[model samples]
Target: MTEESPGAPGGGRPEDVRHRLVEVFGERVSASVPLAGLTTFRTGGAADWLLETSDPADIVAAVRVTRALDLPLTVFGGGSNVLVGDGGVRGLVVRVRHGAISAHGTSTVRADGGVTLNGLVRWAIQRGMAGLERWAGTPGTVGGAIYGNAHFDGLMVGDMVAEVGLVDRTGSILRVSGSEMAFGYDESRVQHTGEFVLWANFDVAAGDPAKLRAAARESLGFRKRTQPLAQASAGCVFQNPRVTDDSLSGGVPRTAGALIDGAGLKGCRVGGAVVSTIHGNFIVSDGAATSADVRTLIEHCRSAVVDRFGVLLREELVYVGVFG
Candidate 1:
């Protein structure tokens, strides 16, 4: 990571960065943009500069400019699983709106990074493609899911991924195979390394359209019943602990939500943030919840789980900006 320089233009200077961004994006840039309206939680403060781009060329240009200016860059997708600080972000926020999906063949589909997971699944199902139907109700964008290795039923998003179009730190585009990329539960190597994903080509399977639709509907129903979808949450708060051969259940660790609920932390509150009573692993924000409140609740859950089960949980959502 590059450290901000005090003397460099646009380095720690929000106004200069904003000016350059406006100059580059024309009317597409905004200052002090409220992040609350941009996220699922609706609880964050403003961003110093927000650049919404629908064109991949624009995104590439903005990235290049920000890099040359030594400004921090934070990428935004569906904003479904992010928790921005109440104090707001300082540099450039690139919001992707490149929603496009095209079927290449009976078993292949290419979608822009900004296309939502649900939308992709629906598109696949409509075309009688089978593989993605299982992910119908998963939130976030195609790029976000691919970056996070979003999974269902022992299958990860990377499994269906054929190739990923990525923009590296130097703004060069490259396509990488899913197998070459390291993928683990709830995380991908690209995500950990902060590589910007542009799009993905998926190799799906052919199936009956009705059957695929049914599968998608069933998955969506399951998600609705189990997850706190009606409330504001970033899906699961922690990744499930890695299973060991000597562990209980012959090696499989219990789900994080079950463990937290077993630890008697469900519905626990810290300020306006609370662990969802319906789902122990989900932290939801009330109308008055702040980023600090959510952080406190997360810490409380982590401590309680560690004390009870000797398992340390890792956060699933990425935190952006300064919270204090």
Candidate 2:
């Protein structure tokens, strides 16, 4: 079957699609899998079809099958930056969990897409490598990090990337260099191309272990002090406004958190979702919060900021599945 091939059996039927997937993927595929436990927010519904594998080959095969069957495909990494809707996802969800890291030549380390950013940081620190130590407390997988050009302080993950191995929409594997990634503030070319990252090689430098550990610890400490790490949240709710209108803020910091705080939205609540008093940008759940609750709170914060400062804040959190 080809990318333009017709759907198999009862076209677009859920059971038919599941059966076809089972035939192709065997035990690797599951039906109606719960999604809440798979994500950092710990909320949302199920995936109609789910494929969890540690093999890049399996990832490519799944994409091919889904494309041939005319089913929608979604790639989930560490599930740290998305809000899956309660209505659930309509098709297959692919989560790659292979996290092997190896030295590429002398100055590069190749990490499987599933490797947690923090895991990569620790790996580099343990080996006395320096570049990743500054991102010690970052969440999600390397794939997700690169997809969003994950940043800390003033540095972006893209800055250290050497190359990326990805499965493009056509199910063809390709190696894209860092320069070709088109990384920007919270974005990469893959987002537009619908390509799936299988692994990435990052540039590293030799460093003293003690110094690397110290830097990693400092990054972790800063996150613990500033963010509500204890609560269930999807990191930052909004991207910091890129361009600030001076007439609106009157010298207030243009950061998303600062704008929300200055708008006096701290401790604001919608159902079980509340804006963290510790950091205005984080919307934490009180264990029982629903996706709807968090989403509503996000809108409330956005509205408040726009009304007060004439600045419409954009979301940093990605929405997955479907909402009611």
Candidate 3:
């Protein structure tokens, strides 16, 4: 291991701490790793320390060491809904790679936090499960989906979540039940609490194998038809504003996408970032889009909607690093 630099924390300098982490993680640890490769936007700079942990024990150790050294720690899952800054992260970046999925019972499934949403969907479909069919086309890991409380057709991932295993700030693991999670529309108590999800269990219903497969295919097809799946985006940029109870009597609730499209903000661009013409809610990064570009487009879209419809839009994706 490299020797500690002068005047650093935990009896070592940042470089020494990084070296120690690399020694512990072995091949999983990388120095000055490219953030572009770690996120969906594919446009940010490198991170000072990027540690990939395939074991839950390693994850706990990484967190403990970073906290002990007073280094900032950021957890990365599938990286589908994040925009890393060009300046890169100045702390420890822990990427979960311990993806595994297992059938707990005829109506239950257990998945590691690193398991991709698509992977979980496929696993469930193969077992004739029905509840997760709606999320067939969503990107990112199961943990990210749960953290963001992702939803479609008024159904949310949290609704199926039966239990979640979390790592607290002090490196203690806690298992929380569904009712204890306190989920809201596109939001969860996990965010405010700063808990790191290690794994989750989902409750699902049994269905015909052929029918479940068809549902998965149809759901994915609908997503491809309506969303810019080929482009670089963090899914929906804004949460849909709530409709009055009276509005529910006539039709479905009003969505931010519909509102933005109605306000004529489709194809809107700020630098290389553009509101996807295919899906007004998605802001796509066209090769060279920066975090600033994405932010500018988000603000512009919100401003346009507010000016035209008198509704203030809320963000769906959580901005991290410098942007946050």
The best candidate by lDDT is 2
lDDT by candidate, in order shown: 0.80, 0.86, 0.80
Q: Which ten residues in a row have the lowest lDDT in candidate 3?
A: 1-10
Q: What's the C-alpha lDDT at position 312 in model 2?
A: 85
Q: Rank candidates by TM-score, best first.
A: 2, 1, 3
Ranking under lDDT, best-scoring first? 2, 1, 3
Q: Using lDDT as the measure, name the better of candidate 1 and candidate 2.
A: 2
The total of clashing pairs for model 3 equals 0
- Model 1 alpha-carbon drift over 4 Å, by segment: 1-15, 245-253
Ten residues in sequence with the least summed lDDT for candidate 1: 1-10
Candidate 1: clashing pairs of residues: none
Give a tens-digit lDDT track for model 2, residues 212-324: 99999999999999999998888998988876355444675678999999999999998888999999989988888889888998888888887888888889989997776
Q: How does candidate 2 fare on TM-score?
A: 0.94
Q: Per-residue lDDT for 1-324 in model 3, tens only?
A: 232222132425766776667667777777677788778877666667787765666667877777777777788787888878766666678887547788887888999988888888888888888888878888888778889888987789999999998888888989999888889898887889888888899998888778888888888899888989899988888988866634333443278898789789889888999999998889998988988889888899888877876778889887766553
Those runs of model 2 whose alpha carbons end farther than 4 Å from true positions after fitting are 1-11, 244-249
Candidate 1, residues 145-254, lDDT tens digits: the string is 87788887688988888888888888888888878668778878787667788888999888999998888888989888888888887888888777762333542238
lDDT of 2 at 168: 88
Residue 324 C-alpha lDDT in model 1: 71
